[model samples]
Target: MVTKSSSGEPSSPLSHTDVASGTTGEVVDTTTAPPAQGTAGAEVQQTPLNIAELNAPDGNAPVEINDDDDSFDGDSAIGSDVGSDTTSLTSSVLHYKYENGRTYHAFREGQYIMPNDDKEQDRLDLVHHVWRLILRGELHRAPISKTVQRVLDIGTGTGIWAMEFADEFRSTTVIANDLSPIQPTWVPPNLQFETDDAEDEWLYTQPFDYIHIRNMGASIADWPKLVTRSLENLQPGGWIEIQEHAIEMHSEDGEVPRNTVQWLSEMEGAARTFGKDMNVAKNLGGYLRDAGFEDVHVDKYKIPLGAWARDKRMKEIGRFQQAYRATGLPHII
Candidate 1:
C-alpha cells in the first residue's frame, strides 16, 4: 500500500500483496487533508503499478467461497423496496415494466438495458462471489488505514458488497445507491441503501473515506462527471477504486473465438445505440487522471473464459465466469 503524507506529496512506496493473485504490491496515494475549496485539482500523474504473475500454474487447491455465508438468518427480503426514505419515492419507483418475459426497473427505465429479475439478480450475486475469489475475500484493493470514516458504494446491485463491507467494518457508516431497490432489507445496521442515479448530481452532505464501484460497465453514461463528483465528495487521503472487466475477450495465443467476438461486437453496437459505452474499463484510468486524481494506479487481471487454466484458482474463476455469462447474456440483450 503506497501512501501520501498530509503535504500532498507521495510517501515512500510500500509493498502490499493480494492473497489470491499474489500481486507484488499496490500503488496508492492519499491527501491527508481535503483540498481547499477554491484550489484547482492537482496535476494528473499516475504511478506505475507493480503487478505479479496473474495466471501462473500453481498446485494448490482452489480457494472456496462459501455461498451459505451470504444467506440471511430471516426470510429473504426479495423484491422489497427498502432504501433511504423509501416512502418519499413515488409509486412509479416500484411500477416495474415487463417485456419479453423479463422485468426491468421502472425508476430509470431503458437507461440500463439489463433486467433486474430473479435470475439476473442471482447471476449478479454469483459474479460477486467470483470477484471475492479473484481478490481472495478482500473487499477492495485500496490501501486505507484503520482510521477511515464513511464509505460509499456506487451502483450497488443486490447490495452484496455494501452489506459485507458494513459487516466487516462495523464502525464505518456505509451508503449504497442504485437505480433499483433490489437490495435486501435484512442488512447490517451500519449500512443504508439509496435509490439514486450516478450520472446525476450527488447531494451528499459529507465526504467519504473510500468509494467503491464494480461491474458498472455499459451502465454508466458519463464517466468523467461521475469521477469528478466522486473526487469532490471525497475526504483528503480518501480513495476511490473501480473494478471492471474490459468487455473484449482474447486468448493467450492471440486467437479470438469467432462466436464470442461476434457476440461482443453486437453487444457493443447495441450499447452505442443507447448512448453508453460497452467497453469502459480501458478508459477508466484516463478518466480518473482527467478528474484530477494525483496518484492513480491500474490493476489488471486476466480472467479465463472456461475451466481450462492450469492453476486451480484460475480454473474456479473461469468456471463461474462461464456460468454467469451463459445465463446473463439473454437478459442483457
Candidate 2:
C-alpha cells in the first residue's frame, strides 16, 4: 500500500511486513522539527479535595469522594470488574518474565519495557480514570456519529477503554489488541480482544470507521509507518484519534530545578536507547495531515503535576496525574 514519506510526498508501495521487519524508509527526525507554540500551560483553578486527608494516618484508609463531583463518577469511572479469565491465547502468552521482582509480558519480549503485572494493570486503570476526567466522560473527541460501523484501538493496555467504548457503542464492532492477552473474557458482546503488535503490518481484513491510539508515544519505532498504516486501513472519511503527552516538565516562569531537568533528560535518553520517542505527542497532527488527511484538528490540555489547582476538578486531575506518573516513572524510565 502507498504511504506518505517524511516530506509529505507519496512514497512507493510498502509490503505488509515492512515495519515489523525493520525494512522501512527514512525515519522522521522529530527533534529537528521546530517546537510547537500555543498557550504556554494548562489552565489551573482551585479544588476542594484535601491531599493530606486522602493520605491521612491510620493505615491510610480509603476516602469516599462525592458522586456528584463534576470531574468523574466515583465508582463507575473505572472499568468493569475484571476476572482472572483470559483469552484463548493464554497458553502461549502466559509465559511472563520476571526481573528485579517484577513480572512482565513474555509475548514480544523486551519490545515494551513497561511491566504488565498486576501493579502495572492497576496503574493502567488509574490512568484510564484520568483520561475519562480529562475528556469529561466522553469516549473520544472525534466528531463521529454513533452509527459508525467498526472501530480499532491500538495498544489496548488492560482493555479498559476498549471495554467502555464497546459498551457505549453497542452497534459498532470493536477490536482491541495489545502485546499481552490480559483482557478479561467477561466483556460486552460487541467487544473482542486480541494479542497483536501494532508496529507490525496491519493485516486487518476490513477497514474501520474509527481508529483510536493512546499512550503509544514510547512504544513505536517508526511513527511515519504507523500513520501510513492507519491511513491505509481506514475507510474513506474515517476518523483516527491519538491521545498523548510530551514527556517533559515545564514551568510557566522558565524556572525548573536542576536535578529534575537532569532526570527528565536522562529519561528521554533512555527511551532513545530503545529506539522510541517520548515526545511524539505534539507532532501527531502534522503526521496525520501529511498522510493526506484533509481536516486535522488538535486539542491540547495541560494536566498539572499535583493538587495545586484552585478548581476542584483541576485539583483532582492533578492529584490523579501525580499518582499515575509516580507509578510509571520507575519502570518506564
Candidate 3:
C-alpha cells in the first residue's frame, strides 16, 4: 500500500492523515491502554525514483557541490584533511564549536554544515527517502489513534521531516529534538523543535506512538543503550524506525572499486579512534531485538561510492553517495 511521491520515490503506506492548518499544539499522554498489535507484511515494491529530482525546485540548477575545502562558500568538500594531517589527527584535539556553547569531537567537515544549508537539505531528502523505505518493512507499523498522537524524531536535523509529518498529520503532535536549534520557530502547529542530546535522559512524560531516529552514526556512542531508551519511551505496540549507513565499503556482485574500500577503511579507522562506531548499521536489528522489540527485521542496501557500479539500483544509491561525498566528506574525514 506504499504510495509513490511526485518524483516516483516510494513512501510509507500510512493512511494519509489530514493536514489541518491552524490548531493549538498539545502533547498526548501515552500511559493509558495501548493499541492492538498488527501483523507484518512482506512486500517488495519498485517504483521509478529520483532523490535529486524530488528536492530540486521546479527547474532549479543542479545542486552546486565541491570537495571539502576551507572557503566560506557552501560548495566545499567535507571530511577533507584541510586543517590537520592524518598523522597528527591522533594527537590533535578534535572538537566542534556550535553557537549554543556545545562542542563534540569534530570527526569530519560535514559536521560544520548547519542543517539549514543546501547540502543539509540534500542529505535530509535522501534520509527521508531511506526512512520511508525502512518503514515499509514488516517489522514497523504505526498505531492509529486520534487520542494517542505523539511522535519523537531523534536527530531531527533541519526539522524538515518533523515539519512534513506535522503538516501531513495535523492531529499528531511531533517533538523534533536535535543537538542544535536549526529548525524555524514558525512551523506547523503540531511540530516543535528542541535542542537535546539523545544520549542524555529525556524529560518527556508521555510515551510516543512513533519514534524516528536517523543518521546517528557519528554522534551516538552506544547503539544498544540508545535502542533501549527508544523502546522504553515507546507506548506498547508503538513503532520505531532507525536509518543509518555503513561506513565500511561494501560491494555487491563485484562492482566497488578498490580505492573506495581503502578510503572507507581509513575513515572507519579514524572514527573508531575517536570512540565512534562506524558499523552501526550491522548491529541495529540485533540491538532492537535485544531491547525486546518483536518481529525485528533488517534490510541491507549497498550504496556505491562512485558511478562505476553496474546495477541500476546500485547506481542510484551511488548517486546519493557521490552527492554526500562531494559535499560532506571533508567534515567527516
Off by over 4 Å in 1: 1-89
Model 3 stretches with alpha carbons more than 4 Å out:
1-148, 252-259, 304-317
| Candidate 1 lDDT, 1-333, residue by residue in tens | 111111121121110100111111111111112222332344432222223412222312232333232211112212323332244567888777898988888887888988887777877888787778777777777765455679999999889899989988989999999998778777899999888888888899987878898888788988888888888988655778888777664434323334444656777888888889877777888888877775566666555544445567765665666565556766664
Give the deviation of candidate 2 from the true structure as CA RMSD.
16.5
List of clashing residue pairs for candidate 2: 45-309, 45-310, 45-311, 46-310, 46-311, 46-312, 47-310, 47-311, 47-312
lDDT of 3 by residue, 1-333 (tens): 010112121132211110000000111011111222331222322122233322212211121122231112122122221111122223322344443333333334234233334445555555454344333322123333444389888888767677778877889999987655445666888887776667788788987777877677766777788787877777667667675665543222222334443555676787777777765766777777777776453434333333333444433433444454445543453
Candidate 2 wrongly placed segments (more than 4 Å): 1-80
lDDT for each residue of candidate 2 in 1-333, tens digit (9 for 90 to 100) = 011112121221221111111111111111111111111132322122233422212211222232243232122223435544585775757888889888787888989988887778878888888878767777776766678789999999999999999999989999999988888998999998989999887889987767898888889998878887877777666667788766654442233334444655677798889899877876887887776664465555556444444467755775676566656767854
Superposed Cα deviation of residue 114, candidate 3 (Å):
8.4
**If scored against the real structure, what TM-score would every candidate get?**
0.75, 0.75, 0.60
TM-score-best of 2 and 3: 2
